[model samples]
Target: MLRFILNNDDIGTALPPGMLLLDFIRYHQHLPGTKIGCNEGDCGACTVLIGELQNWAMHYRSFTSCLTPLGNVRGKHVVTIEGINLPGSLTAVQYAMQECAATQCGFCTPGFVMSLTGFCLSHQAPTLTNAIAAIDGNICRCTGYKSIERAAARVAEILQPRNGTTPAQYAAGAQILPDYFVQIPARLRTLHSTLESADDVKAQPIGGGTDLYVQQHDALGKKALRFLYDQPALKGIRQEGNKCILGGATTVSDLLASPLLQAYFPYLNNYLKKVSSTQIRNMATIAGNFINASPIGDFSIFFLALDATLVLSDGRKERELPLRHLFKGYKQLNKSGDEYITRIWFNLPSQHTLFNFEKVSKRTHLDIASVNTAISITMQYDIINDIRISAGGVGPVPQLLKETARFMTGKLLTESLIREASFLLQTEVTPISDARGTEDYKRLLLAQLFKAHFITLFPQLETAILIR
Candidate 1:
């Protein structure tokens, strides 16, 4: 039996496969604040706020209903726009949206409201940057983004401090699980063995359905979803030893709210803000971005530049390895079929380390990268001491520019040096043609982004690492 509190009500039961979230909420649960949109997961019309216990307490994030599966909701609590209404009147967020005239046609209103609710809780007030980052994934063909930003900020003024705080960290493996992904030719069993095979078949784990939902167009049917929806560790954002460990299910929105990340990786945050729109970031996980294995994953480039490591486990043996080593040539990971990534740890660099990120896309926001670059350089007495540079979207898997790193060793960054070094990169790397950019276009972008990073990292070493 899967025991969960739905909108302050309790339910414990079993369900079938391919049960879209929008339907489950409206039909089975009889809760209808969640609206159905383009069932294909593109339109953000079916968005809702989902809450689950992590570290023995509650944490909430917004997600799209069209792509979400009912089985994924086991043991979790869901709150739609309807539940968000206060006891006597409209919630402060709704009032703000009304005051700012944030809606048009009102079809996308529920999704927009839930998304803003999550955003306002995490960020006291929305800045232009925050506004852009939050709603970038949502579409309002009727009204532009300007009005939404105004509403979000207006809501912030009403509730400066969030009503509650998130609980302590919980590792995914150790948390209290209401159910596991047991293949159901048979139904759910006891409290502890929801995943036990009734037909003795193993389950396929699903996290942050952000990408899996997008895979509906594929010919092959999606594997039965084993919900990792409430895995505490997969939702965590905190420090562990010398590295900052982020869970695979941790949303990009949570990444921006992280004080640790903000203090240590300003450039990384800046680029992630531009990686996708506010709507997508609200649900997409850092690891999912890699799991999707898009050639141009924004976080992939940043992770490589940060010397990040991926931690993989399967309720048994656990292994940790550098992320760059995961690429098995193309669209493939070096997993033994059952092994899935549980968390990612980014090792912290020395305090004085200088790093910069540059993303080249056709548009400023909500677009895939043509060429995304991340550069990390540490200077010792004004000479290059250590360096790591990475490029994404150019190769089958995102990787560090080893040859480019080699060119910068022991050189002083200067205009002439940056220009020459960039040229060396141009000669060493080759990019394939794609819709975002052609082979020659990518080559030029790679060289120029390197130069831009060098210039951006100025004053620390005005000479520029690319020049060196």
Candidate 2:
């Protein structure tokens, strides 16, 4: 059975652990405000706000109901459109959308409103950029985005003077939300104490359920699954000495919000923008990305270049392996089924080290890459001291271009040396033709991306001469 606070009411159910939250809300509970579009979480029509206690503070984030399992929300508060609706008055976000004429056919209105409301509850700066980012996962098919943008801007204006107050306090004081929200943190604390964690020993471990629910929804619906999304042991980003450690179940959203990563990878946000939408990132775990073994996983390729290692555990025992070595073949891993990734750690790059990542995809965002590559190099006096190049969508698995990396070490920073290494890279990858692109196109694209790494890291290197 699962116990949670649904909207304002506490509920328990005897449904299967893998049952989707969308079905539970719309079918069993009979709440229709959360629509069902693109049941695969891409459409974001089923967007809902989930509030969970973290370090004694309540943090709220938007999630796609379709991909979220019922077990994942155990002991947390799941807020739907009905939870935020005022009987005789409009919420700040709702009023903004209505005043700006943001609703078109009204099918996707609730989702946008919920996403925006989640933004309101977030502790982020009430800036236009952050407001716009909150709704990146939502898509309005009627070309009504301009009006929605206006609504978002208006909402940001309303939150300008939030001061240092809590979201519940500020929102309630401003009449954006009801006064009941102010007491939810204490309520959640009591409710959380009574709930026990799902035993993962005898069940399949699923984090976020974003990918698994999409790929194996039918099978998962009937399987006994253990939810890892809220496991305290598998959530956080911390630094120790020269290494940075990230819990396996940490989401992309968590990584983006992490100050440690932001400090080291100043362009972390820009690099992640090339990944999927906010909704996907909010639920997709870094461990899931690596274990999925997709040749084109963005996080997998990114971490590979950093020489990251995975800490694997079976609840009782633990082991560590280099991330690149975990992938043995196409969709194959060098890990036992019982052993799961618990943590990932990588050495921090020095000040002299240069890092670059690039990807070309069908769409600029929310699409799989045709080719993705990353390189981290340290040079002294124009001579390469150390370097690592990693790429995906060009081999059976996410590959560390060993031959190419070895050739660049101790070599002077010259167009000729990198040009020669690019040729060697092509030989290292065994790309095959598929729907994404032809085999030859992938080969040429990877070569260009390699040169792109150099051009991006060393702007002084002429692009024309480097490619030649």
Candidate 3:
């Protein structure tokens, strides 16, 4: 049985764990405020705030209920639009939308409100950029976004006085969120203590369910799944000696929030912003992205450039494999079904090392890459001491560009060297024509992205001559 707090009510259901949260919210709980759109996680029309107790406080993040599984919400507070309403008036977020005239068709309004409410209940600064980013996953076709921008600005303005108070405290005090949020932590502690453990050996392991539900939604309902999203054993980011270790279930949003990653890669946010929307990042796990084996998976390519290692486990034993060797073919992995990734670790980039990730997609954000690449290089004065390059969407699996990296190593940093390396990169990839782009287009795009990595990292180098 899955036990959780849905809105203001407690829920304990025997429904299949893989059942869509959106379906449960609409059909089972009869909450029509969370509308369904795109079914996939693209449209944020089904967005809701998932508040989980962490470090003695409630940390709320917006999640697309359409891609979220019921098992993922166990022992958590699932807040819908209705949960934020006051007795006889709208919450501050709703009032902002109303005051700014942000609503038109009203279909996407709930999602916008939920996302904005999440921002108000978050630790992020009350800035227009952060406010707009909180609703990046939401799509509004009617207002052309100007009014929505105004509404988001208004919401941020309302939160300007939110000083150092906890999200729940500030939100409840300002009437941005209900006072019930203040009592959720204590309620969750009790709920978590009485929660039953699922120990079915025959169950399939699922992390996040952001991608799995989209590809195998119907089939998942029939299979027993072991939810790993909330498992205590597989959830943390810590530095051990020279390596930075990450729990396999760590979400993309976790990476964005990680101080360890930010310390090493100063521009980490700039690179991750292009990975996906705020909602998808909140639920898409690092291991899930690797195991999905999409050619253009953002994290897979990003980690590959770092030469990361994966620790695979089967309950009885553990084994380590280089991430580059994990993928054998298209949608194929080297490990067995029983073997699951439990931990991922990589070397921390030193001051001597420079890293950059580049991607070209049909859309700048919230879209899969047409061609993506990442490069990590250690420079000794003007000479390259060591280098690793990885690219995706130009091969059957995410390619480490071993041959290209080998050619670039020990070479001087110059436009001519980058031009030669670009040629080598093209030879290493076997791009195919697909919906994203043609084979020729992908090859050329990969070459440009390869040059982009050099240009971005080494701004002083006149590498513009290598673009062609």
Clashes of 2: 0
> TM per model?
0.80, 0.97, 0.98
The candidate 1 region of ten consecutive residues with least summed lDDT is 167-176
Model 3 spans with C-alpha error above 4 angstroms: 463-468
**93-170 in candidate 1: lDDT tens per residue?**
677678788888888887888776665534234354554455555778786568888886665444433234321111
In terms of TM-score, the best-performing candidate is 3
lDDT of 3 by residue, 1-468 (tens): 789999889899999988999999999889999998898899899999999989877899999999998989999999999899999888999999999999999999999999999999889999999999999999996855999999999999999998888878888999897788888999999898999987565689999988888889888877888888988778999999999999999999999999989999999999999988999999999999999999999989999999999999987899999999999999999999988889999999989999999988999988999999899999999999999998999889998988988987898888888888888778788999999999999988888788778778888764365444
Worst 10 residues of 2 by lDDT: 459-468
Report per-prediction Cα RMSD to one decimal: 7.2, 1.5, 1.2
Query: Candidate 1 — which residues are off by over 4 angstroms?
Result: 27-33, 38-42, 54-57, 86-92, 120-123, 126-133, 160-201, 217-222, 233-241, 459-468
TM value for model 2: 0.97
Error of 2 at 271 (Å): 0.6
User: Which one wins by TM-score: 1 or 3?
Assistant: 3
lDDT of 3: 0.91
Error of 2 at 283 (Å): 1.2
**Candidates' C-alpha lDDT:** 0.68, 0.91, 0.91
